[model samples]
Target: MISQLFSGIAVLSLIVLLLILLLRRLKQPYFIAYIAAGILLGPHAFNIIHEPDVIKQAGEIGIIILMFSIGSEIDLEYLTRNFYKPLLITFVQILMSFICMYSIGAYLDWKITIILLTTFIISLSSSAIVFQYLARTGEIKSQLGMITCGVLLMQDILVIPMMLTLNFMSGNTVSMQQLIKVCAGGLLMILFLRGAITKRLFKIPMQKELTADHELQIFIGFSICFTMAWISGWFGLSTAFGAFAAGILIGHDKATHWLGESLIPFRVFFMSFFFLAVGLQLNINFFIENAATIILISFTVIFINSLINTILFKLAENSWRDSLYGGALLSQIGEFSFILMTMAAALKLVENYTYQITLAVITLTMLLTTIWLMIIQRLIYRLS
Candidate 1:
């Protein structure tokens, strides 16, 4: 079993390496390479990986850690000062998405539950992909980047209510206890953020001892991340949000700067797993069969989402060029949408065909985001 595990890792690494090289030559994001690698090794292709569920579960850890890293690096002060902008943007974006999806569903004679599910799914933009792009370009701390990050964070927080709504729609009784826990969790998080911002700086325990021990640093960092994730999950919230909260606390501490630095390798490695799982789930045959419809839906989603965000950013006083680019940055549907999709499926809110199509559409949007951003950038350049 160990030998087979080693062999699988070797093959996966080789394929990913080759794909990354090719994508590099084409000036594409590394995520594309990771997803391509998954498709190549997935059941639809070589069928080399037999345990996709295991891979996918592991990939979720990557998301949690990635959120932690983003949280830690975030300029909390800037986010706090401009909090209303993101709040407004996310609220309007969600409202627009609901209205748009409701209109489509009505025209198609679809159910309200389906419309709500679809609305929440498309309303979110992929934090992982957008952050990766910003980090790669060294714009993560820039004004636009901060604004984008704030919007994404707001979207993440809103997932809790989305989940509750879905459960209620599906005839599942959400206990009052759960609601109270969620409210309490949210209050605590708000207070924590407030304190962190007010304090501006703090120190982690055993700072000096942790400085010299690279091995301990990794374990300590992961502990902080996952412990917070556990707490948030217990409170009926997004685990990634919990991890992000932990990161914010750590970020404010000068002594814990090394924590973020120490986890960089782990973040990159696990994040690849997340994208790989996305690729593994892509049904090539299904996509080929419904090529026209899927392609149309994918393009439509990107277009509508970009338009809504662009309008909102412009209203928030951003220049047209930056607003357009910001909209493009958030054009793709987010990873959390997949969780919603899965839940909707389990609750029988959507048909299997609908589930598969949504999955394919989300994957396609993510895959196309880089290309979409490039086109937007060029257009802005010419117009400027």
Candidate 2:
């Protein structure tokens, strides 16, 4: 495993470097080339490695680090007002996603349980990927960009209970009483984490202390995230949701910048492993038999997702740019899908082979985001 680990690192680094050099001439998004390179080198190209479980473990830690960074970056006023539009978009998107995905599931004669879970899971879009790209490109300050970022934030908040509910409902050994117990237990933790107990920590003015104790703030912030994540997973909830909850609480605290900065070197190091691990999941045979299906589904999902986002933005009293914001950013699949797939596999809903197909397609889409956005913007500009 250690040998494979170093090998994976070497492979990813080489691929990333090549993408960097090529994109300069290709004049496209670097990530598109990243995924393309990953696909080529994956089981498809050289067959350098297998065993996705190793990389997935790396991703789990990446989630923890990602959450810590978010907590560190949290500005109190920005977050307080961040919930509304994104919340509205989440509500609107979820409803639409449910209707669309469930209908397809039913028409395909899928089981009710399968349809419900898949629809719910598939409707989700990744906020971490979306927000990072927007911020990196300096678009987060724009109106559409803010809305896009907010929508991503809102989705992060929303996916918590959504995942918890899905996990409990799908458990094969679960009974009615057990399901209720899971819900009650999960709710208790969420309330405790977000409630008065959690708020008191935030109330402490840590600005002065933070200047002197930035490392302490990072420690406390990361501790809270990991602790909350452990509890959520224990209660059959999504740990990622717990991580986000931790951020909301710590963001309210005074040492936000100190905490974020302290964790940066750590987060960046771990997240690269996470991305590489995901790249390792794209095996050759999985893509060979399922390439057509994966491509078709990915295109369909991204296309409709963009349209829905546009319409939602218009309804939000925003412009068609909303659609561009929503659609372009979401063209890729998120890290959350892996969690959903794991749970689904446990419940016998998704085949063992199935998760890789989705992962490959989504990863491809995510990498294409840079290219897709540039081209689509031009197309839209011309159409207008």
Candidate 3:
């Protein structure tokens, strides 16, 4: 087993490296190469890597780190100063999506639980993917980028309630009272961390020591991220949420600069595997069999999200260009949607075939986000 694992790792590494080179040359998203590598190594192809459990565990850690990094970059002060616009837009988008999906679900005879889950899933966007694209295109500090970040941040916070609601609706023991308590605790922690702990954190002689031994600084950074992640799990929240909170607590600190630099290589390595794990789940046969249905559903979801969000942004007084770009950036389903769908499937709320089809549709929508955004931008420029 050890030999097999090592051999599989080696082959996968080589595939990622070569594809990275090709993707770089083509000026395409490098993450897609990681997914392609996973597909090649997956059961659908050569079946080189058999221990999916190991990859999944590693990928989970990768997600934690990714969220941590994203959290670190978010300046709470800046977000607060201009929160209302994005918040209102996000709320409007959610209300509109919920009504539309509920009506569709009723017509299609879907259960209330499924309808609610599907509504929230399509209503939120991928913060990771959207922010990454924005950063790559030098728009991370732009108006649309900030708006997108704010909306995604709100969506991340709402994930807690969404999960608890799912538990309640699925006949789990979770109650509204318990849900409110959990939310209150989470909010209190956020305030405490941002107010007290963050001030104390910067007072530590972190910068002096970090400047001397870089490896120690990296260890300390990981320690902070992991500790927060552990605390979040103890509070019945996702570890990624905890890591992100930790990042926000340390946002723009002198230590964060070095920590970000030190963590890049690890993030790259782990996140590549994370994307690969997503690819491994892509059953080509299933996707091909349901290609038309998957594409149609995916397209409809993206279209509605983009249209609604764009209109909301415009109503919020954003320029047409920025609003359009923001809409395109957030048109796809988020990573948390996969978690919700998986949980729903486990609880037998969603049928097996429907679950598979949904996964395929979500994956396809995510895969197309970059190209779709590119096309949207081109059309925007042409029309303008």
Candidate 4:
């Protein structure tokens, strides 16, 4: 078993390396390479790695770490000072998303729950992809980047209520206890953020002692991240939110800045797993069988989402160029939407066929996002 694991790792590394080299030459993002590696090694292809569950779990950890890194880098004061812009943008975007999805659902005689679910799914853009791109381009600290990050943070916070609504729609009784716990958890987080913003809440026990200790930095960083995640999960909140909060705390402390740097290698390694899992989850047969319909729906989703966000951002006082670029950045369906779909499926809110179609559409949109962004960039350049 150990030998097989080692062999699988070797093959996966080789394939991913080769693809990365190819994509580099083509001037494409590394994520494409990771996803391609997954597809090639997945069941539809060589099927070297038969178990996807392990990869998925590891990928989730990557997300948590990614959120933590983002949180650490976030200028909380900047976000709070300009919070209203993103709030307004996100609010209008969600409203428009719902209206648009509802009209289509009504026209097709589809159920209200399906419309709501679809709206929720499309309203969210891939935080992982957008953030990674922003960071790669050194724009993460730029004004537009901050605004985009704020909008994404708002969506993440809103996921709790979305989950509750889905539960109620699916006939699952959301117990009062659960609601109370969620509220309490939210309140606690608010307090924590408020305190962190106001002043230094506390300090790491051995800040000076741990500053130069490279080995201990890794363990300490992971502990802070996962411990916060565990706390957030206990409160019925998104674990990623917990990780982000942990990062904010770390960011507030100058002594612990090295923690973020220490975790970069881990983040890259684990994040590959997340993208790989996405590729593994792609049902090649189903996608091929419904290729035309899937492609149409995916493009429609990208177009509508991009339009809505662009209009909303413009209303928020951004220039048309930035708005269009931001919209393009957020056009793809997010990772969290997959979680929503799984929940909807388990509750039988959507048929298996619908679920598969949604999955394929989401994966395809993610795959196409980089190309879409490039197109948008060229268009903007030509227009300018």
Candidate 5:
């Protein structure tokens, strides 16, 4: 069994290396390349992985690491400095998305849970993708960029509540008192941590101390993340909530910067595998058979969502150009959608077909986001 595991890793690594080389030459993003590699190596294609369940478990760890990194790197001070704009956008967008998606789901006779999950998945934009593009294009400090950043941050914050809501709705037989207890527990945990930080009850290691033992510093960060995750689970919250909270706690510590840096390589390695696992679940034949439906659905969702968001931004006193820019950038489904969808599947909230379709739609939207942004830019320039 160990030999088979080693053989599988070797094949997967070889495939990843070759794809990375080719994708680099083509200038494709790492996530796309990883997904492509999975398609080629997955059971739907080459059938190289004999134990996909193992890969799936490892991928979950990658997600936990990714969430931890997100939490730790979040610059709350910067976000607070420019809070209202993003908060407004995030609130309005989610409100509109929920109303619209709920109406559609009801009309189609879907389950309430399915409708709720769909609203959360499609309404939120991909912060990782949008922020990367904005930074690469040197727009991170621009007015529109700041608004985009603020909105993305707000969406991420919403993930905690969404996770809790999912848990409550998961058909588990829990009393209202238990639910209240969980909520109170989470709130108390936050307060306790805040008080501790204020009182300096737990001092962050000094840089000089960590500098002498780099490995120890990294372990400390992981220890904090995992510990918080376990505590969160104990309170009936998702491990991600705890991990993210752990990040926000240590994120502000000066000595923790090196810890965050040290985890980068591991995060990247694991995240790649996470995307690969998503690809492995792709039913290539199903996707191919429904290629036209996928395209039409993707186009419709992107178009309609962008149009609604642009109007909302405009109503908020943003210029048409900026509104359109923000809308276009946010039209695609985000990485969080994948996480939520996986959770929803586990809870049996969505059908097998709905899961496949949503995954394919998200992938298509992400791929087109760049092209869509360029097109919007050209249109704005021409109009100006």
Candidate 6:
């Protein structure tokens, strides 16, 4: 038993170590490499290791910590000031991306469920990835970066209701009345929590870091996240919605700065596991098997996705450089896309081949995006 445990540690360690080396050498973002490492150990070609049930179960914690940390960093004043731009851009992006992608789905003769999933997925950019990239590049204070941040936050907020709508629509048991209740409850929760309830939380002082306060803060935070999640579930919304609502609430609190500082270390540590888990689920052979179709769809999505995002950003009174910046930040598929596809597959709305194809495309896009960004960085900075 001891040997088994040690071997697992060694394997995980080696995977992360290899990723670090690749990241340094390639001058690419570590996230791409991390996901690649997970794929290397996945049961596809390597067949050397599988992400056991235990590991996947543990990944749940990673998700929470990540969402929680995001909440803490959210500056209510900053975000609110920039909100209108993101709100408009996000709505346009979602509306246009769905309409355009859904048309392609029609040509592909995709089923309604598959079409819906595609629409949902295409509307999103990876929040975790984009935020981290902006921070790392020291652009978080730049106007373009600030706009992107607001847009991403708006996207997350938009997704909450969309998720509830999807859940209601996707269910066999849901009635019109039931759907109305869910929507109403969600709207009410968002307003109540984000407005009055959260304002009260912000009114409290956390000027001093009292002893043992860190533990209490974490408990309070996790409680709020879990509680919101539970309420969302009860109202037929997904757990992510609750997490988002939790973030918005936490963001409002004046003590959010300290909360951010306290939670970041934990977020970084655990989210590493989340990325690794994503990698371990990808099978190279499966991706290769569907290479032709996956490439076609992925490239098409990337091009159009970038175009739509660019157009929206420009319309929002942003510089052309800012438009391209937004495009570059988004020029790929994301985690939520895969989650929606998986759900569709389970419901027989899509086949396994569809899910595999989307995953392959998303991975390729993500990998390519790093290179895409670097090559354009100089030109973008000059123009901006």
Write candidate 4's Cα lDDT for 1-384 as tens digits.
Answer: 569789999999999999999999999989888888988899988899988999999999999999999999998888888999989888888899999999999999989999999999999998899999999998888888999999998998888899999999998999999999999998998898778657768567888889889999999999989999999999999999999999988898877888988999999999999999988888788889999999999999999999999888888888999999999998999999988998999999999999989989999999999999999999999989
lDDT of 3 at 128: 62
Off by over 4 Å in 3: 175-181, 197-202
TM-score of each: 0.97, 0.79, 0.94, 0.97, 0.83, 0.85
- Scanning candidate 5 in windows of ten residues, the lowest lDDT window is 196-205
**Which lDDT tens digits does candidate 3 get at residues 1-384?**
568868987898889999989988978888788778877898988999887667867877887888888777776666777899878887888899989988998899988888888987898787668867876787766766777888887887787778877887888888567767677768866776766444664443657767778888788879989998988877777788788887777665655576777787888778777778777877778888889899999999888988998898888788888878888888998777877888888888888897888778777778888888888899899989
Residue 353 local lDDT, model 6: 72
Q: Kindly indicate the candidate among 4 and 6 with the higher TM-score.
A: 4
Instruction: Mark the regions of model 5 whose C-alpha exceeds 4 Å error after superposition.
Output: 81-87, 106-114, 127-150, 153-172, 196-202, 312-322, 343-349, 380-384
- Per model, state how many residue pairs clash: 0, 2, 0, 0, 0, 3
The lDDT values for all models are: 0.91, 0.66, 0.80, 0.92, 0.77, 0.70
Cα-based lDDT at residue 362, candidate 2: 64
Ranking by lDDT: 4, 1, 3, 5, 6, 2
Flag regions of model 6 displaced more than 4 Å. 3-5, 48-54, 157-171, 176-178, 196-217, 251-256, 381-384
lDDT of 5: 0.77
**What is the alpha-carbon lDDT for the whole of candidate 3?**
0.80
* Residue 228, candidate 3: C-alpha displacement in angstroms: 1.3
The Cα error of candidate 6 at residue 259, in Å, is: 2.2
- Whichever of 2 and 6 has more lDDT, that candidate is 6
Query: Root-mean-square deviation of each candidate, in angstroms?
Result: 1.5, 4.0, 2.1, 1.3, 3.4, 3.1
- What are the runs in model 2 whose C-alpha is more than 4 Å off? 1-12, 21-47, 74-84, 102-114, 139-150, 153-200, 203-221, 352-356, 379-384
Reference-based lDDT, residue 7, model 5 = 81
Deviation in angstroms for 72 in model 5? 3.5
For model 3, name the residue pairs that clash: none
Q: Rank the candidates by TM-score, best first.
A: 4, 1, 3, 6, 5, 2
